[model samples]
Target: MASDSYDFIIVGGGTAGLAVAARLSEDPSQRVLVLEAGHDAHSDPRIKTPASWLSLLGTDVDWNFRSEPQPLLDDRVISLNQGKVLGGSSATNAQVFVPPATAVVDHWENTLGNASWNWETLRPYFAKAYTSPPVDGTMAETLGIDGWTETSTTHGPVRTAFPGDQSHPIRKIWADTFRATGHYMAKDPFVGSTVGSFTALASVDPATGERSHSAAAYYYPIKTRENLHVITNATVEKVSLNRHGLNHVTAKATGVLYHCGDEIKEVTCEKEVILAAGALQSPKILELSGIGNADLLRQHEIDPIIDLPGVGENLYDHIMCSISFAAVDELETLDAIFRQEPDALEDAAKRYAKDGSGPFSSMGVYSYAYLPVLKHASPEGRQKLIELLEEARPTKGDTPEHARAQAYYEIAKASLLDPKQPSCAYLAFIAQFVGAFESNTKSFTISAMHSQPLSRGSVHIQSKSVATAPKLDPKYLSNPLDLEIFAANLLQIETIIRTSPLSTLIKQPIVHRDPASNLTDLDSAKNWIRKNGDSMWHYGGSCAMLAREMNGVVDEKLKVYGVENLRVVDASAIPIISTANIQATVYAFAERAADLIKESHGLKAAGA
Candidate 1:
């Protein structure tokens, strides 16, 4: 290894890696090395388009880790999709650029004991990571200034609009009708008061409508910088720990250790190594380096250096079930209608690639809906539903856990006799089973998420091999309250869908499936759907930032405990998931992490 040294070596050149590299390299005196396990920033076209999200799955750009069969969903194994590309998942996501509610942050700071993790301090970083363009005077009023990632309503060549769709009119009607029911419309959902419906924007360049990903804004700008080296197609095997007795320790980051292009060579980090390998890999890196819980380490027959029991505990994520509708016409696919049509998808993509305008630029969410289940339901009612879901969820495998999911599904279906009460059956009707939208008649997917999930899961190293993916435990619907919340949210969806103005677009009613009798009962259908729901793929919190006693992996600043010079700066550092899209929050966390790293290392500030 001729090149074995740098001031800072960042593993995983995805969203967090690039952001930290860019900010660190702003000082020419600081040398930064970014090693990516995947390919370069601009190598793939599928990652560039918003509609290409589904295609990015199962590719080299995706880690594609699978979860242990969930205890709740019939012991089903869920696919965990984390980005492996330059910009990471942000490069291959829906590009929805909305932030979490301020309350979410307040909760993290107050409840999680990370005092520096409040929204007031974080707001500036959010502004710095985005370039908010003016939108009907809303941009000036809503978007915060002073950010690196640009945002705007200028839907570029890739932008698409849905005004004439049957769902479009109904969405507005529902918004107004919901407002009459006491819900308020939010002009800026990111600032955190998300009590109502509002359009969301993403990091789309106003001039080109193309996304302003971390790679584009950070890595691409410094491609030729001699002091900075970004090596793609390289995998990190493990962190080499130099443990001095029981107290002192140092690490050597073995980089690009995996085979690539018929060649595999070992690269070492001479300077300090930073594990931005994300929540999943970061812990595995530490575990493979002889860190992690003593009991677990001994079980694996590995010597424990750090003995950090919190290495993979306190894992939390927003597991969601995406309820999708079948399109009324075959022309409803974004490809058939938008791409194949004369000036349809072309106009959007071209505008985005050229000057950053069009429908492709905006966050593609039809509307964000929040329904508080316990807010209106009785304590007993909520408790009973929670108990049922807890009993039903399959926790282990088909052996014992499988029986639970089945039994819970049955009891849950039987509990939804009261149509007026809040329940999962209702949520199914609104989220996935509801009738098709107008104009196109295509089905819509309303994701039923565990907003404040109680279930904790994790990812750990099964081996020291870099070629292997980590063992993941999402533990979906582990907490009884989570299932109840999902059930309640499902009911909310059903309620809105059944309402007058919104129901006008639904030519057909929502269909519910019953497994036992194999018949349709609207109430029980919701319960069945809940049992079979899938993950939203927003797995996070593996390296959660919490108090030391709680076995917190990282501090408020995202610095890994027991490590002198390392940190995990991504969704993994997020103590909790935001109410909105995770991308913008991830960007903000990266931006904040960049600043924190700079201050800690005594680097020059931005523009200095």
Candidate 2:
């Protein structure tokens, strides 16, 4: 018998868990319990200010999990920074608002068993999760007001702009020059299309200056709700289940076993148990519950209740690399200026605190472009990505039907990228990508991001012990084709920097590091990038949603397989990686999952 129990027990009080709790608790009747492995929310200055938040890295709030050494890139140990606190990565991420592409939604409908996941159906949830700040005259017409995550670019007094010359003598030059060169502007990066540069950002309120996180934007508003119990510093060890009579494999879940500091406790759930522990940890929780890969579990001396083989496979991430240039002068750049003049940093901080407008606005990462690397990519690159997706699709079997699926994918690709359409620069940083630039006379920086590469990896249970960290491999740039395309993309970026518009302002040349030894090279900078690239800190796709018996831990409805009442609602539920920042999309997933949970129970809507 359990000492205590609730209607739903949610594990991991980070971005997804909190969102689930917040949405379900709307009724004030249904009880939801959230367990966090980290500390209670704090008023730390570093967390409150967006610019200074980077200082939180490697601190108590960060999970700071380093991956096993990469066999490809000089065996470098990649650092995977996950949020250890209530807000999860949202508290630690740069707060970029790149929404999932519409085509991604279509793909979800086709892959996942539920067709209700299409863009039109999911759009409302996306709108409800955010609250957008007011945009100025010209920008107002461009941005979306319907989003639920509450994004705003209306800079407040204390919020600082990206640290460079907005009026750079070259910004207008580049914008006009790019237009003349025939590049089209992508309207809103989160909606319908994403292929051009538009003004980018989620501006914080000047009156508050503090960045709004999941805790603030979603959970804090309903923190005092009587039905919601949020437990921090409580690590869920495993979920406990009770078997129904023989042959009824769909057993009833009674409760979950978790650790509070060193004490083990069981909290039963009357209705359901949600593993909202994000991508990497969610599958691990299911495995701990004895609900995955039977052979692997038997080896670990644990009884296997479920035979799901896809518990901890299909991991993927975007790896980023960049060119760092020598700044011409201290005043013209943010890093150098702040370093050279302590007063400037102090002044910026003071303004943000006093007025919320200074240098605290999202560090200038606006401007972006999605360029395709493969123009009829080779059969090799498609093999890994296609095989994984096929394994997750439910069209019958690996029979003739499955083989025909390849044609559909090619058609989708041709529709999106028309080669006959004159080849424009396949690289860009105009909106939402370059982030705040330093002063004109200082250092120059341009980053290259892998938008939607065909590389997949994995995160698996190394041991059954709760104290051991799960083994993670991002498999970054694993495919030779991905390497070739990404390398070529790097060269394009180098071309823009070396061209007339940007070259005139260039101080020192950008050095490329060798992939094998991490050494710099004057020639073949592209080669170095392929060999030495690392993640952009975006980690997900583990325990992804798909049809049952189709290599999925969760259903299209986000419910876990073989478990009577378990669901995963976070970045981990994403079947395929989105082409942008994942925070906003995760919030949307939470919002929708909450409604689904409510509907499943035949419960009245929260407000109702």
Candidate 3:
């Protein structure tokens, strides 16, 4: 039987949880316990297959959380589905493994009050978490695969690949399209700044073409370790803390209270209680554990332990809007597969079953461009953005709550004006994004996402029960600047689609699934964004790691305020959301966090 006491009690055996558990338990003398609310789903084909990722949504392993009707988005209730299974969203996501902007990571330290959290310090952690695939031809060039990045540090478990044969004509078309416009990638995206067009890697193993997630990469290898114990179907209710510390200002974590099946169990943590239940649930856990705003806690009849008002505030996401353009009949898009053509389905199944190398090998999102406002927006649009920035600048000494907002506001302004910082991204998914049901019509999608939205929202619990879902309000497009940027980037699709090589592939009298998306004007584009914007599902900043006054829950080392032995090792602690898909950043953040934990306790891993 597993003991009731462990050196570390990790709640939420998802992405970061598994990484920390595996790394911490590297010391055979230290016993680590991981409690997950989901089951062992590694055997599920939907999780293992890269193309079956979308099928995993709304299933038993999905949390299937939705936002509370965004008023700015015409009161649309956006779906914010997160993974409830062992691997978490990493297993269920589109598998696009892209990194954040170099400027953004540097801001984590220079602007966000985090010491030694710059890109220079965290780059190795990214190298330590993923094993890169082999390089070849123009495929390697588009990927910016340099010599050093292909070194021995990439021996980490999470497998990543370029996905499929790179000989597809679309690859060259994409590079040529961007290169003609002087926006081709300047350097390797992995080690430095990424501000232009490049191919994105996916979290799929090249050897087997299966989904490479934390459960498989970090957890499975250590599952047999005597010191590591992972318990599934365990939902944590709260963290028990001891307030008898010096001056009573700090509360030391004692244990964790969780529900396993029908029984409520208590497990003691000899060292620390780490919360890795994702951004949506991590703050709620803290609120339930009596570490939230005093007024709100008492309203729910729960006693306050820390009175940290920042437990569930400052929530934001990349507001994404997609426009699917009809492609020429000659260009073979994935419309047949999405439309479920009998032949296409049979062929895809056969190809995947054969050797995992085919059209079904990866999500068709090879080409991506992280562009600044200069590349797309007209002179008028540029002026409008500048005016909006000045107009929305927080007034002098406006309020304490606006301090962090103001700080972020300055960065957004700098990022927008600076050519090096990309304000939005255009993801090339070679299929109809929303309406791909027309078997006769071949199409491709250009999904524009606002990288650094100034708009902020909140996620607070309704009641004290764990079953009661928190109110998620991303408050998307709340900032006027956000809409301007969204419109600017949205305008770039037509510009690129009209460019040579790529233009030849598009059918005449171009049709969009949403008729409103056919307009070319900036005003109409902004309207489209307000009415059609949805989350990229990159949620963060709820439990931020900033100063306490800036509505932060954790510090530089990720320790919760007023709690000595409590920490959050997930997206909940990420102060700034990454410029692209945040899975890479999440993996790197967890890797660095494990080192921080080791440093604090004077413990070293077996290999280290």
Candidate 4:
């Protein structure tokens, strides 16, 4: 092989890209190169501090792409913030490390027709991706009861730790408030049954109190290897492919053409070319490479190589809205430190610098709760919701894409209606507004998120240029089921606030009308949600992993349909959205993909 060629070429050195590259480079003979569109910012303080995560948004490190004005949200053009740095969104996201519910993973396997993708099979990959700190006797008992086995924190590269004594005092108050409201006391969130309120763990190095991103945890340690080559600030324009000789007419990916500085360069891959460019960019790259819909390609004046219609369809994300209340007492919030009290901000900085122990070490979200709307609703309300869901169910359409969407809708409906499964809404309590809303006084924010939304959207190339971002439309609140779920959760929030311990602390609802105002009316609450809702930043399924007959871009092995030596190993490949933050699941996906790639090439799997 030439100097510019490698055994494998992984595009987008973000979360999954770095993980796949790190695992592949374990073999001494296999050469791997990672092409990242953004610069490496592993040492930047803004990325290291958890409290500074919000600051990274709209900055140069952020892709800062905006969606086409969504029709449902009053035609609002929502900002789709994706990390442009090496670690991708994992570096810039709220470091909450909750795993997907077991039922959600089962849904993916059933939908994709891949039994190996179930929770039990992917569990080892999850353990391989991160190392959690040792749980004490009490915590161990809790985890054991929840069926969570211990992960090796001492040996694994990515570090994960609990807040322990460093957590805010308000966490207890939030947890107690949920308990008072009849929500169950959640155990370990990593055990795939996070159906109650609990103080969640974070992807942070407890010893240093810094964000444990993919770059810091997965890439940095192994970057010195001679077999691994990483190019920063390089954008892959399109993959280069050649038609298979004689028998087969389909083009097989051979290399990648990317922009490095002002120079356009091409690098060949002897074995495979993997795409980890995330949900938004991966589909664009595929379409740009002439691997998408034939008509769509011809419209942009690009010659079609393969007509894979599923390249950019089936996009969905978790929609969230913050219901905030002004804190009546002297309870401290991140708003007080970051926006109001300069002295407190300076003190926190000093403390963080000295011992890595302070409010600055965490992303303000202390605890979270996942509740089924039916569980909290009256018998009549449950029946009403079921009726609404059935009415809103997508009818089978003419196209394969439409049928795929309908299938997904059915899965979402089943999950949401099943009381034994995890809830459709996730509630996270923040001591302060955390910049979600503007308030003059210190405030507490409860983020109500519709986890399993029936609404679907897309990301597609507006032009042939890779520099131009794809048009993103998450189509939030388009489904009536989503609105109903959000409304139910908002009512649940109001119920908690109107109760004892929390009610005494809250002064008034800052964002909505008033603290004491009755927001239980479904119509009024739905209106409030429409005006205030935003994405939870968990985007996926732009290039879904499902059966090819269902318009899936990738197969069970994560291989792209109608193409050879190509795979999508990022959030885009996920068939369904998880019940929690998606970072943990993305890491596990990469870990499993690496093993699959290795096994296919007659190489030993990682840890084998």
Off by over 4 Å in 3: 137-153, 245-247, 375-382
lDDT of 2: 0.63
The numbered model that scores best in lDDT is 3
List where candidate 1 sits over 4 angstroms from the true fold: 41-43, 137-174, 245-271, 324-364, 374-441, 508-526, 529-531
**Candidates ranked by lDDT, best first?**
3, 4, 2, 1
Per-residue lDDT of candidate 1, residues 39-116 (tens digit): 875746576554456678888888888888886777888877878888777777766666666656765676667878
What lDDT score belongs to each candidate, Candidate 1 first?
A: 0.60, 0.63, 0.85, 0.79
Between candidates 1 and 3, name the one with more favorable TM-score: 3
Model 4: CA > 4 A from native: 135-155, 164-167, 180-182, 245-249, 375-378, 434-440, 500-504, 507-518, 605-608
**Prediction 1 TM-score vs. true:** 0.78
lDDT tens readout by residue for model 3, 1-608: 29999999999888899999999999999999999998989989889888788888899998899898888888999999899999888988999988888999888898888998899999999999999787665455444333223233377879998786565667667777777788877555786756887777899999888899999999987799999999999999999988866666668899999998789999998899999999999999999998988899999989887889988888979889888888888776777877778998899889889999777888788878899877435677567677878988986775548889888998898888777789888888888886535658888788888999999888888999998988888888887778877787888777877888778777877677778887588888888887888888898889999998788899999999899889999998999989988999999999999999999999998977
Q: Would you estimate the TM-scores of all the predictions?
A: 0.78, 0.83, 0.96, 0.93
* Shift of residue 198 alpha carbon in model 4, Å: 2.1
TM-score preference between candidates 2 and 4, better one: 4
